[model samples]
Target: MLSGCVLAGWLVSGLPALAAFKLCNQSYDVLNIAIAQPGPEQAAADDFVTRGWWRVAPNQCATLVREPLKTRFLYVFATDVFGKEALSGAIPLCVGTRRFVIERQGDCLLRGFLDARFLEVDTTDQSDWTVFVSPRPS
Candidate 1:
């Protein structure tokens, strides 16, 4: 009987560590961010596969691991009044509710809250985005 109680205590203590969560909010309004890594997990080490994991309205407080369909890994975009291409000059990058694009890949949960953003991406293919995070900007 004492062993059973001790075992329960150990299990309860580990629950806190497993319940941790996080969000990634770059701006006040919602913004889409895709943490992508080129290559396929199923493919062999010698080969490569281009894939992306995306999330709509990824907040600074986001840390929960979502499924493949829930998150994306491709080019996730946020638009102002200009639409998805609003990233052309940064001037139109308004804040507020906006549309979202999602792409599924092996239970969407691309990596985690990366500590950085400035990356030298070869391209920004806005093809994987289908889900609209919002209607439009005000």
Candidate 2:
């Protein structure tokens, strides 16, 4: 099963707003989650807006994107408390040694970031979306 929570609000009073994108942790173990999307302002020049280290307890959820889902592609990298990576696949992205929000990806060494494997998620051009982190069957 998957559990998630979403929040939406306006930047100004008396104005409609966009729904947020959420990530739900359906797995039994707690997860440290990372999210990447296009930068709000800088993405026109940069490629991505990367943020990480959102701790999601089991059966709970976290808001990854607080604004309306603008991009079709989202990236995620997750790990458990014991340092076990909680994702599959070999798609690599730039990550930092600690919690970070990098303006872009690529040139990890020259840019002083670590390379991590992020699974790609296609949102299908929805205004809002949820990623359910289900348990890995044993």
The TM-score, computed over Cα atoms with residue i paired to residue i, of candidate 1 is 0.26
Please give each candidate's TM-score: 0.26, 0.77
What lDDT score is found at residue 96 in candidate 2?
71
Tens digits of per-residue lDDT for model 1 on 1-138? 001000001113433343221223333344333333334442532122222222435223343233322222322222322233212221111122322222222322332212122122222232222222222333
Question: Candidate 2 — worst ten consecutive residues by lDDT sum?
Answer: 1-10
Q: Candidate 1, after superposition: displacement of residue 106 in Å?
A: 21
Candidate 2 lDDT by residue in tens digits, 1-138: 222222222234475645777878878888888877766674354477778889999889788888777778777888788867886345667777678988767777788887778777777777777777887655
Q: How many residue pairs clash in each candidate?
A: 26, 0
